[model samples]
Every structure is written in structure tokens, then in C-alpha cells.
Target: MIRRRTLLGAAALAALATGAFAQDDKTKVGFIYVGPVGDGGWSYEHNQGRLAVEEHFGDKVETVYQESVPEGADAERVMTQMALSGADLIFTTSFGYMDPTMNVAAKFPDVKFEHATGYKTAENVSNYSARFYEGRAVQGLIAGRMTKSNKIGYIASFPIPEVIRGINAAYLAAKKVNPDVEFNVVWAFTWFDPAKEADAAKALIEQGADVVLQHTDSTAPQAAAAEAGNVITFGQASDMGEYAPMPRVSSIIDNWAPYYIDRVQAVMDGTWESKSTWDGIAPGMVEIGEISDAVPADVKAEALALKDAIASGETHPFTGPINKQDGSAWLVEGETADDGTLAGMDFYVEGLSGDIPN
Candidate 1:
């Protein structure tokens, strides 16, 4: 009896030691998402990056995430809870979460924070975004050339620089290829509302738009276009290949795996630092999904060439001889737009109608 009790006590001590080691070995990483992972777009792509971190690190890291988190005070609450729950690193995947992330990071200086599509940063916070406009340029070219009605529709999310840049890039590229191209812009305010997005697409289609591009997340636009039976669409943020060949001719894929893994590794190695990262096609941060055979052979070839040129630094989407919507010259002849201007882009290029909502 005495021997059995001693053995049981020894086993208990061994188990406790093992549990402690396992706990210490794990680096807890948390993610705050603005939409559900199954939204099939922005948040979905971001979640893919989170999954990549888990796969890359395996047992060395533990990850937690909260989906459909609103970007205001709720975001702050979620982030604070994550930090208090022992999160070593937290990624707030939304532009509107910038302030909340900052507020939470200030209280927990030891915890690292990464805010997506936002410009603010702090001692413990960093910002990162993809130059989606590059992909939009390619989509614009396709939309311009393929439209039968000479009207292209853009479903914009917010009136921020990111969405605005996408609009201008697509418009300029489309207008370049098809001089008769006219763009109709619709602001849908919400990023992931399918009902609003679908209604916006329907309204554009009714207005004679045959080619539709979206800066918002969700497959509703694609569904609306597909249901209409003659419209062409491009995927946003994710491949969304389920609707390929017709409506979804191509896509702007956000590849966050490499960045996510690198950052998580930095945390593990004590090399993590607060910095801003903006990367695009050249670095494989933004990828143009496969162009379907539905596009005219010549158009597809030209689009591929343009993509290669952009990737090779031989072409800048916002090249000179461009003007603001008010007819003021924005870029002089042969002058390409600089990063500073692009980062804070607000005005639309000449020939685009309507005012940016305040």
C-alpha cells in the first residue's frame, strides 16, 4: 500500500512538470476579425494567413481568434480580453480597428499588435496593407475591354484611401483601353453586408453596367451578376473560384501566409518590432488570379503583359499626364505617382463623375 501511494505521488509530480513545460513552450497568438471567416472574401483570406501560421509553427504556437468582431469599442474589448488572456501577439484585421487596437496596445505595452489597412502605429503596434490598386488596374483593363455597354460598375466599401485607390486604378486602366468606358460608382458603406452588396449590384446592372468590380467583401455581387446571366465580375480578396468562368473572370488574391509566418516567427525569436509594411504583386503579397478563357485571347495576353510589367517595375499604374476629377493636373508628363501620394489618395482622376462622400 505504501509503495503504491508513493508511485502515485511521483506520477502526479511528473504530470505537473510536463504540463508546465508545455504551457511555457506555447506562444499564444490571437486574431480579431471584423467578419466571419466564411464570408468568402477579406476576412476569409486573413483567416487563411492565421491558419498558415498555425501550420508553420505546429506545436510551438497556439492561436485564438474572434470572428465578426465590430471595429469600435467591441474591438477594443475583444483585444483587451485577448491580451489579458495571455496573448503574446494580436492581429486586428480591419481598417476601422486602428484606434481600438492602439488603445488596447497602450494598456498592454508588452503585447504586440498588428492592424490591417490602417496607418496608425505605436511602440507596440504596427500597420500593414496590400497595394490592391495594382490588381485593380488589371481588372480594369479586362472590364474596359470586355464590356458590351461601355459601362462599368464599381462597388466601393468605404470612402477611405484604399477603396478610392482601387476605384481610380480600375477606372484609369479601363478608360485607357476603351476610350468610351464610363464608370458608375456605388458606395455600400458596409464591407460584408450581402444584402446591401446584392442590392448595389442589381442597381448597377439595371443601369447598363455589364462589367462589375468590387472593393467590398462577399460573393453576393458575384451571385447577383451570375443571376443576371450576362454580367462579368472579378473576385475580391479571395479566389472565390466557385463562380469562375463567367461572372468571376479573375480575382485579386490577398496572400497573407508569408507575412503572417514571418511575423509570428519574429515574435518567437524576440525580433518583433513595430513597423509599417505595404507590399504588392512584386513581392507576391497581391496576386492576380487566373484569367478565365472567357476573356478575348488578345485582351488576356495584354492583361498578362501589363501584370508582368507592373511586377517588373516597368509600369506604374498611376503614370503621369493624369488629372484630378476637377481637371487639375495631378501627375505631370512622365511622372509616376509616388508612394506618399498614393498612401493618402482621396481625389478621383479626371473623367470620373460624382463627389467623394464626406
Candidate 2:
């Protein structure tokens, strides 16, 4: 009887050891979102990437996330907790989380961090963003051609370089297509406020804007446009296609799965390094969604051609003969804007009214 008990005890110990080893072998990834995963826009797309990671790695990886995390002290706290909880890699998916991501990364030197739509980097942190302005150019062309009022509405988020670049790119393309086109920008200042976004869209529509573009997340703008009728919109950050063929025509879909999978693989291979990645349609980072049947066949053809040109490097969205809002020559004819200027873009291009908020 004593001999049999000893053998059973040995078997139990061995099983426990194997279980612990299995748990330790899995690479754990963390994500901090600024909005709920079901927002059907930015965070939703990010969550899709996370799901993709899980699906790809199977039992080799573990993923965790905290949705709707505010981008200040709360974000830092979440990052710290995730790090403490054995997160090998954490992706902070919002521009506002930049400073907080840096702060948390300093304390957890072993853990890798990735920030989206930000420009900061450190030894343990990397930054990445899509060239969304490329998509905006296509949207602008469609808007210019589709709008009866010749007045386009833009629902802007914060006045960051990313937002500013989008507004400029859209305006430039629209103005090129329709010389009489005008842009009415309403700054919502928040990334995913449904009510605020809806209000902004309504106000624009009321002000004679027959078309709307947004840099903010959430499908509220699309819904608002649908309700307003005769107003068209483009999906922001994700394909909010439920309102398609009318209010929501085309979209700029953020495809983060490839990047996320690559980064996580780096962690598992012990080859993770900090670097910035800014890719657009060419590399499949930013995708232009389907142009709906509502768009005229000619305009749709032109938009697709523009997409192909941008992807093939045959077109630069900020091609020259452009001026700053103050009427200063920013780019001479045939002189495309450099990466430096576009990265740190702050001022509005010529023909855009009102000042960028402080």
C-alpha cells in the first residue's frame, strides 16, 4: 500500500510541473483600447486584429484587453497592471495614449509596447500609423462628384497632425475635382462619442453640407447622415457598411492583423525590436472599402484609379501648387510634400476656412 501511494504522488507532481511549464510557454499579449470593441469603428477593428492573433496562434498565445480605457492616468494604470500580469507585449491603440504608454513602458523594460497613430519611440516601445490621408483623397473625390450642395462636411477629431493631414488631403482632392467645392469642418474633439459625432453630422447637414467625412471613430456619423437623407458619408477606421449604398458609401478600413501577428511572432522568437511603421494601401495597411452602387459609375472608376495610382506610387496625395492656410506657398507645382512635413503637419492648406483649434 505504501509503495502504491508513493508512485501516485510522484505522478501528481510531474503533472503539476508540466501544467506550469505549458502555461509559461504561452506568449501573452495585451491591448488597451480607448473605446469599446463593439463601437463598430476603430476599436472594433482593433479587436478584430486581436481575435486574429488568437486564431492564428491557437494555444501558443494568450490575449487580454481592457476596452474603453481613458488615455491618461487610467491608461498608465492599466498598462502597469497588464505588465505585472505577465503581458509580454502590449498594444496601446489610440493617439491619446502616447504619453501614458511611454510612461508605463519605462517601468516595464522587459515588456514590449506598441502605440498606434503616435510618433514616439523608445528602446522598448514602437509607434505605427496608417497613411489614412490616402483614403481621404479618394473619399474627397467621390464627395466632390456626388455632392449637389458643393459643400462637404468634415467631422474632425483632435487637431493632431494625423487629423490635419486628412482634412488637407480630402480638401485638396475635392477642390481639384470640383473647383467650387467647399469644406465645412466641425471639430468633435473626441474620438468615439456617438452623441457628439451625431450632433456634428447633423449640424453639418443642416448647414447645407451634402456630404460628410469623419476622422473620428463610431458609426454615429453614418447613422446621422442616414437620418438626414440625401447626405453621403465615408466610413472611418472601419467599414461601417450597414448604412452603405447611401449615407455610408466607401470606407478607410484599418487592417492591423498582419502587423499584430508579426509583432507577436517577434516576441515569441525573442527578436522583438523597436521601430516605427507607417504603411498605406500599397502594403495593405490601409484599405479602401468598396464603392457603393450609389456612386456614379464614372466617379467610381476615377476613385479606383486614384486608389491604384496611390498604391503604385504613381500619385502623392499632397502634390504641389499647394499653399498654407495663411496663403504662404507650401509646395510648388510638381513638388510633392515630404514625409517630414506630412508627419508633423499642423497648419491647414489653402482654401480651408477657420483656424485649427488651440
For each candidate, what TM-score against the reference? Answer: 0.93, 0.93
Please report the TM-score between candidate 1 and the true structure.
0.93
How well does candidate 2 score on lDDT at residue 352?
95
Q: How accurate is candidate 1 locally (lDDT)?
A: 0.91
Write candidate 1's Cα lDDT for 108-158 as tens digits. Answer: 999999999989899999999998999999999999999999999999989
Tens digits of lDDT, candidate 2, 80-130: 777777789999999999999999999999999999999999999999999
Stretches of model 2 off by over 4 angstroms after superposition: 1-23
C-alpha displacement of 76 in model 1, angstroms? 0.4
How far off is model 1, as Cα RMSD? 9.2
